[model samples]
Target: MLKKLYGKLEISINALESWMKERKNLAGLLVGIVILGGLIGCAIWLNQPVEGEVPTSASQMAYEKASVTAVLEDGAVPDYEDAEGRRVGTQELEIRILTGTHKGEIMSLTNYMSALFNVDVEKGDQIIVRIMTDEDGSYYASLFNYNRGIVLGVFVLIFFILLAVLGGKKGLGALLGLLFTLASIWFVLIPCLIRGIPAIAATVGIVAVTAAGALVLLNGFSLKTLCSVLGCVIGVVAAGGIAALVGNITPMNGFNMPEAENLLLYGADKGMKISGLLVCGVLISALGAVMDVALGIASSIWELHEQNPSLPGRALFRSGMHIGRDAMGTMANTLILAFAGSSLNMLILVQTYDIPFIQLINTDYICIEIIQSVAGALGILLTVPIVAFISARLMARGKRVS
Candidate 1:
């Protein structure tokens, strides 16, 4: 009787333990859902357009979709070699409006084609048309561009399908995290900058928020996620600081950027802080890579400690550093090569013109590219040690306490 009672007690205890574990997991899932839902609601609220913000001229114009019904005329213009030796011509087409206020209206429009801005279309091709209203209530329509929205939509769908199929539950978590990051940028960061918030501070705040949220969503609430979040924020801020210091020393700033003039003209009245835009850009660009390095090191260190709870903090630290060093080479090269690839056209131009090395290096465009690449790489370098040290200390302490 005593032995049978003991066995029954053991089974009951095991069942209780299993139940507690399931309850804990369910609680975590509930918390995650709440946080994610709140974030989405906030994003939607912040994305609403402000009333009376549209200019008068822009309010009088509309874009509508149309399909080419017939090609009424197509002829090349003579002596138009100015288009880089490419054919310059014009096309007259009859189009039927497919959407907006003029849906089902048939009209004849002139479509211009050139080497730089060509939209050669055939019959049955869908395109975008810009319509303008005059004071007398008359309207004019012109060919704007080809309608590629369906193609883009389909491509994005394919990407989501592949991500879900390959990654399973983890992939779904990653997809949610990605959407959160984009929402924070578009709904929070850009709006704050446009509303005259200090660019550097706003960008850094967004970087931290997005990093923390993404890591939490990806790994759930854990010491590893916390360490990675801290490491990523520090590394990205360090990169931005380095870029800002270089910009000040070289007397280069957003004003030297190609789009600065246009931004000034459009955003001056809106109180935009253009000076810090360059540093803001660097912080955002470096964030993904920094987060990757930090999480990788932290996760590795945590796994090491889990496998051998007897390992000392120093041993875990050393193991993390070794892993980080292996990652550094490829990550640094990745940043530099990305920058170079984006500027391939400019590099080709310099080579074609046989630009002197001194002149080439001194150009603002070239200097900006170099600073971006180097600063981002330096951030990754710093993240390695930060993540290693933090992960080691935390994992070791957890083991000791347990």
Candidate 2:
């Protein structure tokens, strides 16, 4: 009788534990759903057009997707003497509009192709046409460009499929997190900046929100997530601060950027702050690398603590530092290379002209690029220690209590 009672007790405890585990998982799912819904709501609210905001003239122009039903003529004139010569000519095409108000309308269009702006197309190729409406209710159409949307869509679909197949549940979470980050930037950050919010502050706020959301989605609400988020935010902010300081010292503001003139012309009257945009750019560019380092350190430390709960905080800290050091070199190099690759054209120009080193270093564009690369690398470097320290303390303390 005693033996039977003991077996029954053991089975009952096991069943209860399983039930509690399922309940916990269900609760987590509910929480995740609620959070996702809230984020979507906020994104929608932020994306709404602001009252009194004037639309650009370009927005009034209509572009429609169309297919080249027939290529009526192809005239090409090529320059033989110039090494960089390109074909410049025009093609007459009959197209059928596939979208917008003119859907299924067949029309003849002229496609002017030049060395600088060209879209070579064959029959059945999808393209975009610019439609201009006259006061008399008549419309004229011209070739704008090739409609590459379908191709881009296919590429993106493949990317998602691979991510899902390789990453499984975690991959889906990452996909959601990526969408959330994009929404935060497009809906929240851009609008805030347009509304004249301090660029640096708005960027920082958005970074923090995105970082928190992504980490939570990936790891759930946990000590490791907290540590990672905190470390990431601090590292990003530090990078921005460094960049800002350098910009101030060099007297290089956003006006020194290539697109500054256009921005000033178009956005200054719309209450956009231009001066801090440089720092804002630095923060955004460094965010991914910094976050990677922070999460890596925090997760490693947490796993170490889990494997050996009795490990002291100092020992965990050392392990995290070791892991961080291994990551630091490669991550820093990644940031520098990314910045350099973006400016490859300028580098080529300098080399082609055989520009003096002094002149090259003093150029505003080069200085800005250097500042961006250095600040980002420094951010990654600092993030390692910060995340290591935070994760070590938190994980070790949690272990002792448990």
Candidate 3:
């Protein structure tokens, strides 16, 4: 029975290999299509609007676009000021709704000219209006903001067009991989966390799957993919481990992040582990940088081995180490700078408040940022040599055996 099973398994592997070889070009295309289709399905499923019970006495609200029909009045209200040290006032304007149920309906709105959060409008200006109705059917409208979606949409269109034109097939693959990464996080990772799965375990599994899937899709199922995936796994795990250890020993709380207090309140109520989540964040933050280094080292080793198929294992390892050292310099800087950029405002606050050096260093927020940034950089640094060694061994496998 065992022999028969082995025979069947061997036959299945051979058949699948033969089938893939016959449709080599179609395989990558099909993979991309399947991933993209799954992403669209996830988006549709997540965004399906659910009908809720309507409140009978609640105010009705709707957003609409409008065009300023005319400036009816302008005067100083003494409640607001302009940037030029002049007292600003209210401006009343007649406007016509261009969208929503109020299309073509004319109305009037008052704009209080404030230095901030107010839009000064004139005739022919396009604007957004927020309509609110009382239970007695009385309604009021206010200027919401300017219509900015068109500008944003144009920029998005330009980005995709440039990606396609510049990157060709690889660009499509990259886009698909990006979509997959996002879907996995939104659909899989978050849901699992909400369901009370341990954060570290869930993060490790999700990241490993993401790394492998993305690498295979980008590089195909080759030694390069394997090397990169393995390296990423080690790096991410190491980063998480370091974060967990440091967080436990230090006085820092996971509440150092924005909105973390709310999350902690909710998460604690749900029995979620804030410390684990913090470590998970550190792991994920470092993941992209580590994956970059892994890919860089693996590709270099693969290229070197390809050029000298009979190169000695020691020689290949040495070459990989040399390449990794060069990559580590910039990759470490990338991780550190990325963290610093995100916390630039907070850093400025410390300086602005005249925080002492020792106090600033011991502060929970700054310490958390330091741990996250340093741990991630350390992960990248470690992944380099690990990837270099593994890739060299695997790429030089046949040569070494011969």
Candidate 4:
């Protein structure tokens, strides 16, 4: 009985040793995650309270407040309106400040006949208000945007907890992936962009770093991972080239991005290919899905070969194509739908104008988005065949050697 017990003990010890060897990197990842979580906690603490008072020379500022009552167009309406209409035709809000040095301030404001949006503002509603200083030396309300920091914080904390408790060591690897992605963006990609590196180049650099980091963490030096990496790089180059070509021919002006337009106006104060930037934008945006498709196809083929080591390379290639076809079909639609969802507002605008099919598709935004979607689709399309072909040869090398 003692010998049997000892034998069991030895087996358990060996298993534990083997597990530790595999998970040693995971321990380091957890320590890093804890450190990162602490840093994020510090950042959240710093953003709280959001500057006690809006500084002077402030173009606009908003704050949350409550009010006693509100009125609209010849009626003393209830503080809260169940079916609030538009802000128009001399509608006014009657409000009382709930907090701050301006507590108990009353305001009768014009609603300006604007349709009340999804998040409505009304008297007694805890709402944000833009501070406005009139020529008469008095401050008043202008506009408001919602404050959602607290909600966002709660969501983020819950997600982190989910990762830690549910995933344990694997969660730690995920956290490392997050850090890796962020660092690649901030250190490598952003710096490249700052140096005026071509956006495609910067983005490809970032994606390469991302692919390497993820593959190493998950698959180490395995042939599957290496093949996937090579396949992803090739796909990205092709995708970027396609995007650039399509974007150059498209009518979308360089100043299309609201934020980018403003930044360009500030940065150059003059001649910059706001349009060339658009080309880069399209390329960078689609590169991610391209990499994902490459990895998926390559890894699938590699795993198939691992499972059936007796299979020849040609057979494995065929099997990978089968997998790739199924993946490519859904993935192409998914990519297109993802882009469509983002441009739903643009589509709505086009519908509002009753634009003809030719005109609608010809629109710069539509054209630009098409280029992005097509580039991504083409890249994904190409990656499957490439990864399969490469992984097949590499996997076959093993069989030949054996």
TM-score of 1: 0.89
Model 4's alpha-carbon lDDT is: 0.66
TM-score of each: 0.89, 0.90, 0.77, 0.66
Worst 10 residues of 1 by lDDT: 78-87
Q: CA lDDT of each candidate?
A: 0.87, 0.87, 0.79, 0.66
Instruction: By lDDT, rank the candidates, best first.
Output: 1, 2, 3, 4
Candidate 2: regions farther than 4 A off = 1-42, 77-86, 400-402
- Lowest lDDT 10-mer window, candidate 4? 266-275
lDDT of 3 at 207: 89
Candidate 3, number of clashes: 0
RMSD of each: 3.2, 3.0, 7.2, 7.5
Cα miss at 213, model 1 (Å)? Answer: 1.6
Query: Candidate 3 lDDT, tens digit per residue, 211-317?
Result: 87777766776668889999999998998888888888885556666668877765565556665677888878888888888988888888888787998777888
Q: State which candidate, 2 or 3, has the greater lDDT.
A: 2
Query: How many clashes (backbone N, Cα, C below 3 Å) per candidate?
Result: 0, 0, 0, 8
